[model samples]
Target: MKSVTILLYDGFSNMVLSCLLEPLRAVRDQSQSALHWHIVTPHDGPARSSSGLNIAPDLACKDVIKSDLLMVVSGYGYRQHAKPENLRPLRLLTRQAASIVAADTGSWLLASAGLLDDQTATIHWGVISDFTEEFPKVRPSYERFVKHPRISTCGGASTALELMLAMISEQFGPADAFIASTMFLHDAAQQQSTGRGPNRLEGKGTAQLRQIVNRMVETIETPLSLEELAQQSGLTRRTLDRLFQAELAMSPGRYYQLMRLTHARELSTSTDYDLREIALRCGYADASALGKAFRKAFGHPIRKSRGSRPH
Candidate 1:
């Protein structure tokens, strides 16, 4: 059986841990004896997560080398907890493992050990800049997740699950991945096909409405006005507005504006761009306008929101 070791510690995100494990469990349940998982920690003790959930590790870090895959799961205090002392052993373990994956902030641990030196890596979008600043040797991509030569890094909880699903697809087949999605109650077609993460086009609407949402997402960095959006959709302004409200429970203009803000938030946290640059890229006239909208929507200023260290 293929063995996967998930590294856990204090302040780990329980949701991310679940996302990575569920698909793998599905793989095992479907294929019978195809895969197995083991949870590891610095010490075999109760590891507390940032969300106040604690998990017991099955083994210590020193014993993690026996696994076929090693995935380090991390959260807010990762840098402090996932330090050189703790990572060196895991880094050594990497030599014997089939693949090493980092869930969310755990990418930092991999980068810290020089594992991502020449590999494409990603982490939680909120900490991307700090990660880049700290590890200039690594290439940072805007993808939700990226799998390199021997390393895989994911952006957030959602992408963490995608990485797992992609792994299942690679190991078993596309069919297995699709089956796992159905068991997980996710859109299998959307999960594997759409490059965008899930829920980007979630609304009970017609095909034309889905196309309109797609177009809006495409133009997120350089948003179109309501009139232009409707024109592109081959619908009148009044009709488009009515459809958006009826289907999405929001006006077209509001949806478009929120799309821009979402793009701005992702860009702000995932890239080295400043507020001004992000604003320009997200179709805002200036930083101040973007800041106002961002604060109003997220209940925090754009500057403060970047590099979210988890509550």
Candidate 2:
């Protein structure tokens, strides 16, 4: 039997936890190998998710027994939850467990406990810059998930599943992992092949449209005009507009503006960059110009949008 212990904290993401657990459960159901899991919290009692759903812990932090693997699951308000005392138990677990994994912002907690020092890891992409700035010793990666010796980290829900599937492959075999993936309707090959591009528009439009979208993403700091985009796509301005309308139901200019606004929103929320810096990165003249565009596109102030997210 392979024993796994999951450490849960207040305001942890239930979705992320489910993604990591379901595949393993499937493996246990389908294979002869026994997979056992227990959920634990820092203190004895229940832990509530950000959505207010409470999960009763199987054990308290102090009573947690050694396991084959220990994974910390966390999400919003991680900075506030990652207190010194909360991290002490994790530091102890690092020495006890054969393998350690951090899911989502759980990397922040592990990094705080100094377990990720000199190890490559990743967090959710939305906070990659903030994580990198905060944890200089831990090498932050752009990959969806990173596996190191005795330690691993994953970005978000889907990536968590990917990490678990890969672990299943390592533990049992590729056939067992494939069976588990099939149970979840997950296409492992497609998931492995997909890159972290701007968006998923590869099969939605013509080759020319894909080229134009790729160009827009690559040149967010210096966006091209419609004429330039069309020229690069080997189409005239009118033809580009028609193609976009036919494929995406939006004009080329609107699509371009939406793309820039999306990137700006990501920067505003993920990075510590000021408004002027974000504007320049999104190819606006100044903060004022970016604010107007953002409001027109998203129907809310950038500051308000950023503020809505948990710190």
Candidate 3:
């Protein structure tokens, strides 16, 4: 039996740990194998999770000698809860594991322990930039899950399940993975084998528009006109205009311009770029033109009060 230990801290997110463990339980039940797992806390007392749920651990961190896999889970208020003293044992345990996994901001713990150097990893998308700025040597990946043989890291929540399912598929078979998926009902309902899954929007012709919108966001530093966007997307200008009006309740040109202005404001306040350069990069002829548009749209100058970072 392979042993798995989940390192739990005061602010750990229970959902991530559950997502990681539940599938393994399902797999174990189907195979009737002794897949051992133990929840380890810094101490013997119950640890509080982000959702205000308190969990009692099976063991203390100091008692964990060796494990095949160690999953570290973290959440909001993690910085306040995570102490080097409490994590020191897990840091040592990481070296002995067949693989180390971090869910959500758990990467912070790994990075702090100096375990992620030169390895590709990822965290929740919301904290990507901050994590990058803090850990320069670690190559940050945008995938929901990134595994380099020994170290497996994921963004958050469902991505943890995705990582497990992918790993299970490799160890077992795609059919068994699909069975696991059916039990979880996550990607399961992609087939009828899993009962009625959650209702998902079929996108109703909005999928293509969403793809185009994503491209516009990426090209914010080099804004494109509606006609140019339509040409690039291989859609007629009229079709693009109608799609925007129906889905976004705005003209294509208006939506595109707003996206550019939004990115310009983000760059101005968060980055050290100059106003004129920001304007030119956003496709404005001059800084004044960009400022006027910015004020008209947001009722404030680009360099005025700092804007809340996008979530």
Candidate 4:
């Protein structure tokens, strides 16, 4: 039997919490792993999310028993909750638990407790610069997740799901992990699969198509022309067009344009970069060109996407 303990804080993301728990529960249901979890808080009672969803904890932090894995979950307003008194239990767990995982901004709390010194870690990208500035001893990564020997960190809910799935594969087997992923409608091949399975895009299209897409993703800041992309994929322009049309229902040019615009939208929402800077990063000649393309693809002005993000 593997035991897991989750320390929840007020204003934690309910979605992130569920992403970690649901897959493990599904694995337990299908296999004989006997995976169990206990939710703990600084005080024994309900912890509410920013959206008002409430979760009841099974134990107070001071009363938590040792577990194979201890995960700290934090979201908005994490700084206010990461006081010394509230972190005492976590500091104690560092010596007791087998491994510690930080989810979302929980990395900030762990670093505050000096648990991540000299350890490679990652927090949500939106706060990564702040995390690095505050904790210089902790090596911060731009990856979606980082897994060290005794400590791990994840950037957000989706990466947390990936981390848990990888842990499940290590404990059980790849087959069991695949089953759990399928239950969640997640295609394991698209991710770093735990088991030796076919990639999600393996049979969906030719290898050339996958290669072309990867190239586009890598060069988002300086996009390649359609002819250049075709040459790199070792295919003619016509074949590239045919393959993309058959596989993605769009031309290679359209798909590439959409990819760049999608990246532009992410930058707009997640960072404070101005339109001119974002446009240059996305390979646009100017802000006007970027705005025209963004509106065409997403049906809204770029400013609207920036304004819609939570303040």
Candidate 5:
């Protein structure tokens, strides 16, 4: 079981807090690994967010005994919140927690406490120059997030969600993380790469592309070759490839392979089927064949990714 503690402060960003909590909510619902969380403030009082929403603490920060993960989430007014009274408990809890994560200006608080002296961390980009000037010892990156073994930091609200998803995938396996992403319809990887929201592609030009995706979804168990897909869709192979690349951003063959692998992963996690059976059902030749592709896609073998079906 993983016990998570959120150390929230006044003037926090509600969106950043939600981004930190929502992925944990999804994993607690879908993960085989047990997870629990509690929210707390400096003195067990209500804290107001930047958007004027108030959150009452479940406990005080000093009351915390230990935590598997400690999340420090602050936004505006972080400078004022860096007093020794607040930083003292934060330093203690950070030392005891298995991992320490900070969002937005949260890294400012940690660095102020001397908790991140030797860590390479990222903070809200707007404050990079000030942060570097303030904390000469801590290396600051301008990336969306930085994931270190013991300490990690995210730059903003959306990156908070991205960091949580990666942590979820690490602790509960990629299958659970993928399932959690479905719950929110969040595509963090694509969003990061494209610097835009998910492309719905629900336009007149995408009718055929949508049909092709639907076909891929329907044929997960018996994937069709690119030639077969083209013939069935009344498209030449070149046209089929163009349609997928222009909309879905991958070739027909690559999409079909991914489709089959996803189903294979679902079965591995949610059912009692052995690897050989799952491979055959997902259109692979055997366990070895599926293992090769699965490792490539998820960076883990199917056996290691298996877990009790989430209740």
Candidate 6:
């Protein structure tokens, strides 16, 4: 998106704002998009962070012309900031913004403005009980973040980063998101859908499941047998199968294949490895076998998707 308006209020989280902006900065640097943003406060002057940092605004909220994306960020005392003067401008901005994001306590302001009526949303976990009691019509999800086409809400910095990456993936492509995710050293162990079908292996779940997935990642070049996988995780095949199916909605075999293919895709995009080498690295016996599986899943040969890129 070209134009972004970040609406801040007093007592916002400095770290939350950093998490929101840093990923966008990374996307701007990594992608071909001409993304830019400006900060705004409800009235004027500056917004103070919970950590005692003062950030002067670029413009008043009422003066915002338009925004491709509007981000509402706040922390303590967000309810008091939802007075008529602020709500009036927030409602107007929401109607104009193509997409909306509420990070940390900002969802409270959006809910107060009646913007979250009848929508499934989430807020920082600490305030979720109060949020539920305050907004009876809104359906609340305990997800780290709930992202839809028009609006999204998240709890903390890590979830905010995932939300930004999801938006980047939706707008640009997964490759850019992947680069940023890895570059940030984001654990990415989120449990939610993320609006993108996340690799559950790289996400949050039970310790045993994580143990198996870690083994899978480590054995990409020489995939472990299901028997070996189960043994390493200290479980039987049936138990492992049940766990993957129940949690990730897939059989262990299928999840392992997805892991291999996803790893293969990443390697193809980020490196100059030949198909045969990439195939071998991803645990495929040879180029032909890898080609068959890769095409079946991704709808194209790896060579074609690789294309010409920087080494």
Taken over the whole model, the C-alpha lDDT of each candidate is 0.74, 0.77, 0.72, 0.78, 0.78, 0.78
Candidate 4 regions with alpha-carbon error over 4 angstroms: 186-311
lDDT of 6 by residue, 1-311 (tens): 88999988788998889878887876665443578999988767888889888999887777788899999998888878876676876787888799999999888889998889999999999999999999998899999899988889998777887788878777766545544554343243322224333554334365566556667767889998999889888889999889988865568887788678767766777897888998999999998899999777655577765663455
Clashing pairs in 6: none
| TM-score of every candidate relative to the true structure | 0.60, 0.59, 0.60, 0.60, 0.66, 0.63
User: For model 2, how does the per-residue alpha-carbon lDDT over 250-284 read when each residue is reduced to its tens digit?
Assistant: 68787677667766766776788899999999999
Candidate 1 Cα outliers beyond 4 Å, as residue runs: 184-311
List, in order, the clash count of every candidate structure: 0, 0, 0, 0, 0, 0
Best by TM-score: 5
lDDT of 5 by residue, 70-127 (tens): 9999889898899777677677788779998999999999999988898899999889
Model 3 earns a TM-score of: 0.60
The parts of candidate 2 lying over 4 Å away from their true place are 186-311
Question: Which digits, one per residue and each the tens of the lDDT, describe model 3 over residues 1-311?
Answer: 27888877777777787878888876664444567899877566887987889989897776778888888887775565456765676666787688788888888778877889988999988888988998898999998889778888997778988888877777654433544554444232232223444443222224476467656756776777778899999999999888877854468777677667756765775776788888888988889999999777655566662343333
Please give the RMSD to the true structure for each candidate, in Å: 18.4, 18.7, 21.2, 17.5, 7.4, 6.9
Candidate 3 vs 4: which has more lDDT:
4
Query: Residue 165 of model 1: what lDDT?
Result: 77
Those runs of model 5 whose alpha carbons end farther than 4 Å from true positions after fitting are 186-311
Better-scoring candidate (TM-score), 5 or 6: 5
Please provide, for model 4 over 1-311, each residue's C-alpha lDDT reduced to its tens digit, 9 standing for 90 to 100. 38899888888888889888888886664443557889887566898887898889887766766889988999998887777777876787666789888999999999999989998999988899999999999999998789887889998888888888778777775544544554443232324244444554422345556567777877888999999999988899999999988965568887778667756776887899999999999999899999998776555688876864557
Residue 267 of model 4 has an lDDT of: 87
